[model samples]
Target: MQSNDGPAIDETSSSSSSSSSSSSSSFSSFSSSSVTVTITKLTTNKRKSMLTVNGYEFHFKDYNKAKTIKFLRCASRNCGILLHKSFSDEFVRFSGKMTDHSHLPNTAALGIRTLREKLRQRAEHERLPLQEIAEQEVRAGLLTGHNLLHNRRKLMPPLPQSCDFNIPDEYRKDYLNRDRLLLHDSYDPQFQLHESVYKRPEGRTLVWSSDVQLKLLFDSEKLYMDGTFCTAPPNFNQVYIIQVIHHETFKLYLFH
Candidate 1:
């Protein structure tokens, strides 16, 4: 028999109590597992900070803040395929070191002298005109000498004065006389003929043709004449006489 002060427990109520206890235990296990995962995350981040590749230490501080590494195919003409990519800093440093002045060959020091000697020999072998080669040699010698003199602290000589000699009276008189004779000799009869033939008319005259038929008719009968003149003794005057011939009889008539 049941006691009067206590409530009787049902099967369903007992099962419900067991399920709630199981759920509480599972929740505690999950929380503890999360703590271990957070520790692993921290360790992984620390390892990442010490990462290295191909024996080169990764120093982010040496790089500019805005700089970024690019993955480009190798740009060498012989190896354009994607061999590797590099940071711009490393590439620029490598290029600059390769092109440093100390890397130049020893022969480059005497390059100009060697080139000049070779050219001189070649010019001689080809039997080129000596004057041209001499001029070139003189120019090269002058430039080389100037450079040497400048390096030694020597001053250049002053240029020659342009006005050095006085003109003699007899020479000046001969030059003037020769020029006057040349001028007098150049005034020939042919120039006089051209001047006479192409003289400007005394006054301007205007002739207008109206109709096409009339123009054609006048042009059919039109004649052209030309003549030449020669200089006379007393004066420079010359004359040219021009005549138009009649179309029917070919008789010449002086044009007004």
Candidate 2:
């Protein structure tokens, strides 16, 4: 059964050569127009699906499940440009008028959005460290200094408002599907230090160590413990580190 909502595709008789030629011509025209639109699917910083038609960007606004259609609106604040797209198992077609953007196409913004998405995906899936992922992105793409902080905030998790805030699962591990790096977490709201001014625990203690570090610590005979206040992160006062001196290798290895 043919669906009434979609455009009817004509079937040509094999015996009629003229009908086949006309159908072929119509298909060629449709294919050429589809090439002109140059639709690129991309992800926004907020991880939303977006589409770029020609040079203008549009955000997914709504979907009509009954008709298998998706509606999109211009990314601009007040732009009236709208688009409709139909999808099926075989093909995707865009309806309504395209190239009717209210403002000049921002190719720079589109490029940045693409780069950010690439970085986000690499951070999640790639075994490389975040610094390496960012360095690779900078070498591959052109980035501007003006939006550095904005992009950083998008990639990093929000700072906890208080010590009682829960940490996300991703932060507890070194990478996706990798072994946990957070070795110890001692958070006590009622725990207090001996200092007279400090009545309650303002921040908790945390220790991070990797598998290799643990192996080195286990193999070493002598261990050294040191504490530093200068390099401590915000919300924490000091960083206590443990270093091991391996007997066989005769090398110093810092674990945490």
Candidate 3:
């Protein structure tokens, strides 16, 4: 009877220990699920990628290429939250701990950031005029002021520093049709330029007019000449504009 009673006591103690261990394991899993981090990807003003978690934004601080992980830090000032994101699989997975934020999230700033990103993306891919695009975005965002948010020069070619730079072949012709827009290029003889409109050797003058415009100028009975001194290029004293009057409507059109 003593031996049977001892076996029963040992069995009860073992079951209790097993139950405690299972409860601990379940609690651990529940805690992990409760604080599961969800990451939201976004773009910075410079079009760089960033992530947001729990209304806080994080930017990349470092990268671990071999481990396929990205280390990020809170964008807010003095915020100590750090994140480790794993990119080894098809989806991004979050790791490590994040502390409580020092201040509340600024939803206005976040909205502005999102607005700027949208403006930049529209500027990049769309063929619509910039003014039209900006107006549409401004109305959609309910933003004030007429200032454009995106960089205007993003799609434009870099301006040449000096007159000695080479002109690209595409720029030499009209964009609508492949017609010669550059009538003369004195510096570069390879262009097979026309004779200079002004014969002065010291103050060399360049003129641009299509063949059709020249024909119209010759056919018109009345011609108008206007010269602008203030708007001329730095090297020139004045810019002369020749105009022709339409026969039927009497409207003036630029001839040169």
> Highest TM-score: which candidate?
2
Candidate with the larger TM-score of 1 and 2: 2
Best by lDDT: 2
lDDT against the true structure, per candidate, is 0.28, 0.58, 0.54
Candidate 3: stretches off by over 4 Å: 1-32, 64-66, 88-98, 143-256
In model 1, state the lDDT of residue 21: 8
> What does the lDDT read for residue 46 in candidate 1?
21
Judge candidate 2 against the unseen true structure and give its global Cα lDDT, from 0 to 1.
Answer: 0.58
Model 1 misplaced stretches (Cα beyond 4 Å): 1-135, 143-147, 151-256
Task: Give RMSD to native, each candidate.
Answer: 44.9, 18.9, 25.2
Give the per-residue lDDT digits (tens) of candidate 1, residues 169-218: 33222222321111111123322335455663332211112233233335
Q: What lDDT would candidate 3 get against the real structure?
A: 0.54
Q: Provide the TM-score for each candidate, comma-separated.
A: 0.15, 0.38, 0.38
lDDT of 3 by residue, 169-242 (tens): 66565543356666666565564444575443444445566666667878988888888889875555677778
| Superior by lDDT: candidate 2 or candidate 3 | 2
Model 1 worst lDDT run, 10 consecutive residues: 16-25
The best-first sequence of candidates by lDDT reads 2, 3, 1
Tens-digit lDDT track for model 2 on 55-122?
A: 67666666654546666666676686655565521223343444345467887776676676677777
